[model samples]
Target chain A: MKYAATDLDHFSESTLHTIPLIEAKHLNLSFGKQQVLENVSLNIHPKEIVTLIGPNGAGKSTLLKILLGLLTPDSGKVVRKRHLNVGFMPQKIQIDPTLPMTVERFLQLGLKIQKRGFFRREYSTTNLEKYVDELNIGYLLKQPIQQVSGGEMQRILLARALLREPDLLVLDEPVQGVDLQGQTELYQYLNQLRHREGYGILMVSHDLHIVMKHTDEVLCLNRHMCCSGHPHSVSQSKEFQDLFGEHTEAIAVYEHHHDEATCDHSHGHNHIHLDETGESKHND
Target chain B: MIEMTQFLVFALLGGIGLALISAPLGVFMVWQRQSYFGATLAHSALLGISLGLLLQTDLTITVIVVSMVIAWGIFTLSHSKQLSSDTLLGILAHSSLALGLVLISLQNSVQIDIMGYLFGDILSITKTDLWLIAFTGVLILLFYWRHWRDLLNITLNPQLAQVEGTAVKTVQLQYILLLAFMIALSMKIVGILLITSLLIIPPAAARRISDTPEKMLLISMLIGLLSVLGGLFASYHFDLPPGASIVLAATAFFAILQLKKAPM
Candidate 1:
């Protein structure tokens, strides 16, 4: 559970060659005078879906922003492979209903508009229509952005991000405001993309169950990382246990050791506990 | 009555340029909800005009220089952590306007036509004014053309824009410079008093009709052009101020569009 610093360093170094997509060394971050992240080192690989999971104010969003190159760390080397196109789906900001914009127009923006110059590159209306169709929101292409549902907007954004065929996708709470069905559908679509394209996905999410089921890896962050590995292992580790507490029945079942005596575990339960003499002990 | 030919020609050129430039930029401003900022910038043009009068320089050059200075000042002041943006904009907008008024008052011998400048005189637009307007129009077109994607990216999401290798500060600089030019040149047609309306109204009207930003901009320009021509005709026929008539025309267009039953 408590891997030594040297062990982590060794693991990081050895894994660097095989699947290194992003590597950060001795990262230190601060907002004004307050230190937010300290002596953090992490590596993310290609085709890996890393979820930054933590409680509120655990610096999950901050670390994600840093990874996206939105914020600069005070002391760190964030080495990314050259020309790595990163597609970002930010947390939904409040959009005014009166403002008029369509899904098709929005998707066209994601294409490399800067390459040809602004307003100079004339977008084919047919091509934009095709891209919006590919997003499965062809029906919503003509609707006002303000009029669309949150789930629909998220899809439109997803379509926009995918238009460029990015190398890496950075999503911050992609399913934050969507309904249950919408969330499921989005994840299914994302999973399909992951399987097909092998693009790296780093998502910051609080939906533990879905993330546990869907993601390839989990990066448990609490200012400092508690663990980063397979979700099943990371969730069962002492750090996760200590942080989330031994509350969930499934996790408790996983954490319980067969060699330990079962007497103390039945403190508040209605079930019986037996001693070595096979005599029942009842608190009531 | 004013000559119809002169009115049509001047209004067409000025109105088209103003509409095209402002509609796109205004959408950006409105999206960012920087209407107050736009108002402040427009108000600061008075100071630029006054500075031009005081320096005995080309009016367009003087206005451009003064507005750019005010814009740079505002940008610099806003960047400081101490002052809030609203407080800064309020102080700068009023202070510049007041300073411009006082300076103009002090220059008694120059015999400046303050009313004409404020209300606009389309008939009075000389060839020099036309040339300046044309040059500014081309500059704005080129500038926006080159940086359109970057501008949209920053407007949509500043943090994401930074991540995507956009030089946000530099883009912002370019945007402000273009805005200054637009405001300075627009003063000849719409006048400083009504310039912000021209910048904002057409876009607002067009947005109600179009679902896409590109279409919105185009529609806004069309609406603006119609208002300018209609206002000019009305002004010539009915003996009214061109600026006031143009603004009223735009407002009427907005009202008519609102009265339509179907949602855009």
Candidate 2:
């Protein structure tokens, strides 16, 4: 279905009214007998970057998979306002060296290829080439998918997804296994795409610090959605504190340390003091 | 000496059709990592051929019916919780091959060229064979034309395809039917033992040089046609077996393409 330009404006209005682009209600997912996601409810707004974060075995990826239609939840209702053309960038895909596909070719596969009545149109290679250029992956277009570096591969996948001009982009750890520079570049490009295209993004990531800075909302999912709202609010929620006790404390300490370093002041002498035997005291 | 015009016509029709059907089907097989599935299906064709011979029926009809049955049966059984696809395919592949061998062996009176059929007998292809191949090719082409998008979607991601309103299971059945048709017809040209090579090798070879799926498929068809024609000609001159020679030609082309500079 063709999406009109006004659709973005309508979507933005809906979000203002607290109507989600996608709403998952009372979702229950189980693999065999073990429950993965239990009564998880999530609402994602349009043109907003929502980050799904949790500890290992926290069903972050499972929730993303269910949303992307990769996994069918055992019981729940997922409501969507529009037919979402979802562009998914899965966690790292291992390309066999024997596979002789290029990045441009990979991207074109996502496009709908149709034969006209009685006459077939000559295949055009330029459309995807232009997309590769737009995604800043021109050099990667000709290279074998197997030979490209992880960051380059991620870019190529992003370009492939973007070529569809999808309404929503779902990324499962898009920056996982990439270096810091690569992660930064990917985030920058994603931000640019969202601003220009107004496509909604739902990203599942373990890198909380990076996501906390760029995302519009944070969904802390541990079996069920523990909290949902602004990153700062979720991070400070009691549920988050209870679920990630020591880890959350460590993050708070690190943030405080970083803030103190940036502000050029000794903020808290009590929390950072010398212990017996000349050892530095730290909160556990 | 072989008639140049007749050989060219044979190569053009047979090669092009084989290539067209295999290219798309092969891409799915590779994507699913189901190369073994093709081999199993090809092996099962021997049972079809054997049944045809025993019943004194038309080879094409017998082979198609038998292959489709086995394919459908395997498809059904694989769906059951009792038997996995790997286990079922292994059982069927070996049993059919063994049964065909035994049944053919029992007939001590008739002198059939078993090796030629096993390897390939491209030179011995009759007018009826050509007609069957051409008609089956059209059917496959029509099928592919109707479900091109659905096929690609399922190949890339089945779950997504299902969610996007495509009948994933129905598409899968159509794929198996198309593959069965291709394998059944290809057996007469490449032989049951070597049919999967024609289905898989050309696509694998073309994958190195082409970028898009369509281009890769076109290149694969061209490669298959060239290999078939070149191998037939080479076998005629060198007194080699046509099937072995064609497979060798394809292998050589694969090696050269791999050694050549990467595609731009």
Candidate 3:
């Protein structure tokens, strides 16, 4: 638990005192006869990153859709602060080949739709170049969106989401196609954005090791709220170990050497050894 | 000779109007992979034709209304999860068309040229059809001008669009209704059977040559206009069916463009 407390680190401690950017209260949903989500609730405050991790079909996406107001929960509701602008990055988007759209045009499309209410002043206009350069997607701008590689597509999508200049960013598997090295860079970048802009980030991810180091809260879901707490505690919890099995040990180690603010520290070669074990378990 | 000249002018104007509106709409249909949806709408339009004839009402209005209703029906039924959309579309398309044919055959006193409805009589375009196409073209342009970004956002991903504050359902419903109106208006020039061809071929041809959505829309419109002009000329000289001639001309463009491989 010993870690350096920087000026940026104070926000994590003070987040609970400030009103949440978005809050979900005892949400429940079902599709026909099957219950999809049950009594799930979570809060996302500014300068905080909450990662939702779950097994396949664990209602992770369902919860996100509810949080975004894309789907109405059968019971319970999501509350957002007035004029809260949300930037969403979906898992993957399949653009029809017949629709010829360049990456730059895709980013620009985000700027075209005027968000409802008066809260879009912060994002202003024409942040497309800023995000494109930051995400390192400048070279892919003129290329057709459909032609981009998977990793490039992820960055392009992230850039598009960032162009919205949202107060809260909801990313679903934001680093899906990115390599291990790119994943760390993206997490570092997101951490920077959170600290610099005081924005709240809610992401769904399966990359427990990388995400664990960066996220303030981890909501482990399996059609219900299995566990919710700091990533370190959640990884050690019985529910997490039961759900994720052998991967918890590696994540716990990954979480220890890393602190929220610093990204330059080494993970030690022993951590890589654990990552292979986690991957091999995944194959089984 | 003057009457012939007037007939050609009206046909050209009406054909050009339809082509202009079809470009943006057809490009979307192709992009959304809903080409079958357009065909389904056109097929059910025959039911509207039969109803209009049976009720002795204005055929165009009734056809437009029925097309809208069918389009709405398709939109709602697509959520049922009972069958794949293509299967559902196929069932609705042929059944409504069959019902229209059955209803038309039941009428003993009225004499109608079934071939004219099936293939179209573009050379016999009246002033009323021209006005309706012009009005629809205006409406399509206005709607698209305001909602182009929204529509493109939705096409990229509806959930993402919804999150970004675009009313996905409302925008989608409006687009579908406009598609119905366009299909109804196009029936007179292309006929119910060939209407989808007019709505699909130009966009498909344009895809080979254009590198952006806006460019595709523009190229499709140009291709559509050319098809109308070339088809009219060929039909005038060779005494061929204008609707079929127009579709063939579009197909020719699509074939010729395919020879130049599009850059990946």
Candidate 4:
């Protein structure tokens, strides 16, 4: 299904080596008097996951929508690779109460593209069973989508998005309603998925603490690109500190702890307690 | 006496056909909460009616065109940042109805039954009207047969459907155009005032019992058909207005079904 790129000469050699999944340059969008997005430029390449982090009203959603071509930008350009397939998992889709849709039926709605002919033939993709098992939504498959919990719904949405076998996975605040533990598991699962499939993932997230662990890069935005780099660099940068304030200094960018077996080089664990006169209690 | 019987048969046939035509569209109206949109179309139909009478054109076709034009116009105008959809629908519904009444009052030559236009008269349904119902009924069935999945997907989520390459705008425009047609044609069956009820109630009732989308469609059609029949029978027996009788029958189904719990 890969079509040869005809405009390969237009890009630089570095870009020619591997085409980016999505490239947006200086995108600007506004609604009447309110400027929502300004001079936003970013790129998502395959086999990488980039996380978008911004405060409320920072136009993260607007930028994501623009990249997906749902909303028109005032002035800019977004070039998606030819025949690029995007599996979008929205924050939440409100289905009307009148429409009766079970989880299985909800997922089946995603199958319209693969369905052929008048008979439909019950089309099934190879990843359907695999993702269903991976996400552990087998029990929730038959239940009404409205009845499922928020965590379960996120997993189901992820499962449905995975079924598309997308070249790029676009998620908008995917773990909004899920609890703490569930969020960690979801991000872990996403990391595994990205590593296995080599799909480019562009996700919008609000949780700064947990997401930075698995995220390769974080683009901090506020109606424009403030700063963007790898987790450690972005977290330590003055732009991030100014935007988030001093409280962010304590936040670890990634899980600093590793199993003893994984890291053979062990540093000495020493703690000295300060008593009334001097450091009295010492442990090594 | 035979003429009276033939007229009654025409009325029954027309009622059944119109019910079948309007039922599926009604399901969408209920699901999308566009009952007021139906009412707006029905109200504006008075302008269509007045225009048809003044111009010596086919009333049904004139009404359909007029409603479609109005629907398109409203869609275009609502894009403006000035007014909200609720306000626009309200203004259009009342102003069009008022203007229509004024226009009809100016026409001195042809005698018009305003009550019949409002509440409907089953006995007055002509053979041509019956044929239009048959034509529209079959057309609706063909449309449902060809584009049911696309229409359902669009109704569920237009943006999602569009991303899936479902031709959302075309399906939506077609659905709205067909809805305008139904509102125009169903005028003779349930009259302008009761058209929305006929379009909404049976489907809402069907929603109570149905598990799947296909089942919902079937049950809606059946309920609508039964309402027409039961209404015709009650109108004949109790000498009530046929359209009102039909609506009451549908409401009875809603009430009766309300007693039975929705299945797990």
Candidate 5:
């Protein structure tokens, strides 16, 4: 159900033609003496994919949390289109071993019926199944949620996030444990999803090359807004180079190989070895 | 013969009521790794009892109040960054228990059996105690029925639960309050010291036999009921302490389930 946008906020009304789904301006935060984020400003518009790229300790997750309102920034304001629904995929939620939950039930937990104003919508079983089938995770539905393989786990989390039917998807390191093949497929799917649903996508990724191909814009952060622009321009910026080291040139090789589906010969070989070792390690 | 049967009936009903609520609470307590929190509440319960005796108030009511106050106190204190939660729990648990011992001993006007409070005197459960158990059991049932998913979500991840638009803080506060009430009412049947055991062991045993949350809850309740029955029976025939016997029976179930070959 859609409520009439009668009470639209000034931010939305002012930009009547193309209102941003969410906007954060001049965000500054600090924990005691150390500053985590400073003067970070970004806005997500409909059908846009913004990739937040930063090294460890760059406060990428913290920024995402501030955007999601999970944390309160010491200063700066976040504006959202009125009644915006955000589907947040956090980095690695550790489920306790004692809690026995199946993947189907884990997905079901994401089916929260949000009530904003007089409108309400029901996320049905069919919708859940549609996502499950779309992600090819139907096989894993009956298995214990904790026991799924890394690649399958990523798909399952993406499915859970999609179950919310969010206006904007905020994923923090969505492909942390996923293999190279899985990562490419996930980025492709996210791009396709954005085109189909027009949902704004804001995701944080540690890998610059794989994510840069799909990202409309990139924000390079390190305790501040180091650089922000199109992925090409951001990579060209000196600040981005200084922060990420001389790896800027290496992004070209990956970008060239990204289009060729048959270029994963080496990746496929290592993936098997990684999976075996990972499985053995997990058993312990 | 009638009097003996009457006492048995009261004990059984009270035990049944505690078992029903304890399963769900115990499952969550174990899932959240808050068994220590439950123990802390149980420890403070002795303080509640002493406070009741000194003030000439109903022991059950005073225990519930003191438990809630202590639960709230711990909840707030845990937010401070100085001391870890277990450290805080350890401090609160021992100090309140020592204070309770002091208060109980200082009061020369009242005659109280400390052993009964520690290990429980289930056979001596009064009709009033059974009513309190039933009332608390229904209240907890109604609560879980409404917020079962919410509790599960919270257990899985509090931040995710908050993002999903759950009233995480509110649900958590209510859960703490209900847990306080459960511990207070349970102190009489299982005694204050053994209350956490009742809220923990049945679920621990049930974990072996179940593969789903709902199944675990139901199985734990069944296990808890069985322990109560077996313990009461043992107490009658063998002249054992009922609370200790019940806890032992639960441990026995845990051990027995361990012998069941792990599912292939």
Candidate 6:
């Protein structure tokens, strides 16, 4: 098997890592007579981030619901590894103004509800603080969940998902309401988390630049899978352009470096390489 | 004196126990803004009454079965997405009440006490009714105690709950069934029209003072107990209907809480 070996490719050359952590086989879901998703199949491997992109009314939410087991597919099967755990960060959730919930309580609700038996013990608060600190959400812990800004809420939600220590992190619009700077930091943090924890991240996003730059695989869907593969390949495919329009073609790949300060310290001021068409390869 | 004490004790215990169990259920109702949903279920209790009279079986059990069926119907129909939940509940609530009235009117032989069902005569609560309320109360409290986190999670956002490995369908069905049972059992205490008030007002008022969900539930239970006590007292002294008095007392508590300066 001749594999494409390039310095630019970040995919580890490990043939043994073939089994996917999660698999959906030929999923078909319909609402009454109108079919939403048709014969869709997708897979997620350990330490891989796969992004699903589609236009409005294109069954994106339906597909996400199916994957989360919230909606049943008409004629398809989803297989997860035995005892496979998933942490899901949903799209923008609006809490009723009447039900006052602190961010700390909101995060705790996710961990506290994990039904545990005699064998498994729940995570303690002190242990969860580690994730809170890592996500830089410690400041908002005491604040009301409803009062937190959109970016802060996103981080809090991420922190809550991290508490589950899931095998796969499924995020639907993880940075929807955040600005450009916050979005980049979140994506960078996610990339580093995947590398460090060997997690399989599945995210649904409309940000072409971020998905093109960071994701290992991109699946373009318009009811059916139009085109899917490497982000570069998908963006170039005629089917993808047909579904997404030609404007996506000009989105230059934005790559970031940590500089001497490193993300370990507070300041993450970095440089971006606008690789037009991404034909240039990075060494080391 | 001892005989009087025993009678009063049973009534007091039944009312208070029902109030405690209602707290957990009520909190979810308020949080999810499903008071109307509860009202719809409560209204169908009148239908359950007619069905019970028609079946000539255990009235409480028949009521439970009918309410469960209606609750399940509302649940399943809402999933169809053809009609909004409010529209469905509106149709079901009023139509079921109207149907129940028609069914009762058809039975010329049965001189049904319709006012008793509409406005609850708690003084007539049987020993069997007391025991049923106590048993169901214990079951509900246990369900809420063990599944406290699950219930709250589902109420917070069911989609997130599903992702966290909660069996959303099973939990939801259990919740709906329990809600049906509550309405069926409490029909004797607060009647049909006022059942939702007990489920909503206490918790809604509790939100003003509570900073956490658990605290809210506890405070709601306390508030409900107070209302029951005050209502029973008023019924005894003023010869007022016990169900209406209880709901009125609850409304008073709500008004008082609103009047108090809430910590912003």
Best-matching candidate per DockQ: 3
- Taken over the whole model, the C-alpha lDDT of each candidate is 0.69, 0.70, 0.82, 0.77, 0.79, 0.77
True interface contacts reproduced, per candidate: 0.47, 0.19, 0.87, 0.28, 0.62, 0.60
Clashing pairs in 4: none
TM-score of chain B of 2: 0.89
lDDT winner, 2 or 6: 6
Query: What are the runs in model 6 whose C-alpha is more than 4 Å off?
Result: A1-12, A112-115, A118-121, A124-127, A254-284, B1-10, B79-81, B261-264
Better of 1 and 6 by DockQ: 6
Tens-digit lDDT string for candidate 2 (A1-284): 11121223322233555556687888898877889998887667667778888889999888887787666789998887676677777677665554556665566656533334432433344457666776678877667667888777777777766666677888888887776656656776676677667778899887656555556567777887777665555677788788767555333322323442253222222223221321122221
Q: Candidate 2 docking category?
A: acceptable
lDDT of 1 by residue, B1-264 (tens): 357576567666766566666777777777677778878887788888888888889877788778888888888777645778999999999998899899999998877777876777666666666777678777777777778777776777677677666788888887877787778777755687567877778877776677666677788888878887888789879998877888899999888887664354
Candidate 1 displacement at residue A166 in angstroms: 2.4
When 1 and 2 are scored with TM-score, the better candidate is 1
Model 6: what TM-score?
A: 0.88
- Deviation from native of the Cα of residue B201 in model 3, angstroms: 0.9
The list of candidate 3 runs beyond 4 A from truth reads A1-11, A112-124, A257-284, B79-83, B110-113
| Comparing 2 and 3 on DockQ, the stronger one | 3
For model 5, report DockQ: 0.43
> For residues A91-148, could you state the per-residue lDDT of candidate 5 as single tens digits?
8877777788889999997885744332234455556988999899988888888788
lDDT of 5 by residue, B81-128 (tens): 568889999999999999998999999877888888778878888988
Model 6 chain A, poorest ten-residue lDDT window? A1-10
Residue range with the least summed lDDT across 10 consecutive positions in model 1 chain B:
B1-10
Q: If you assessed candidate 3 against the hidden native complex, which CAPRI class would it receive?
A: medium
* DockQ-based class of model 1: acceptable
**Which number leads on TM-score?**
3
lDDT of 4 at A206: 69
Model 4 chain B: worst 10 consecutive residues (lDDT sum) = B156-165
Q: How are the candidates ranked when ordered by DockQ, highest leading? A: 3, 6, 1, 4, 5, 2
**TM-scores for the candidates:** 0.80, 0.75, 0.91, 0.88, 0.87, 0.88
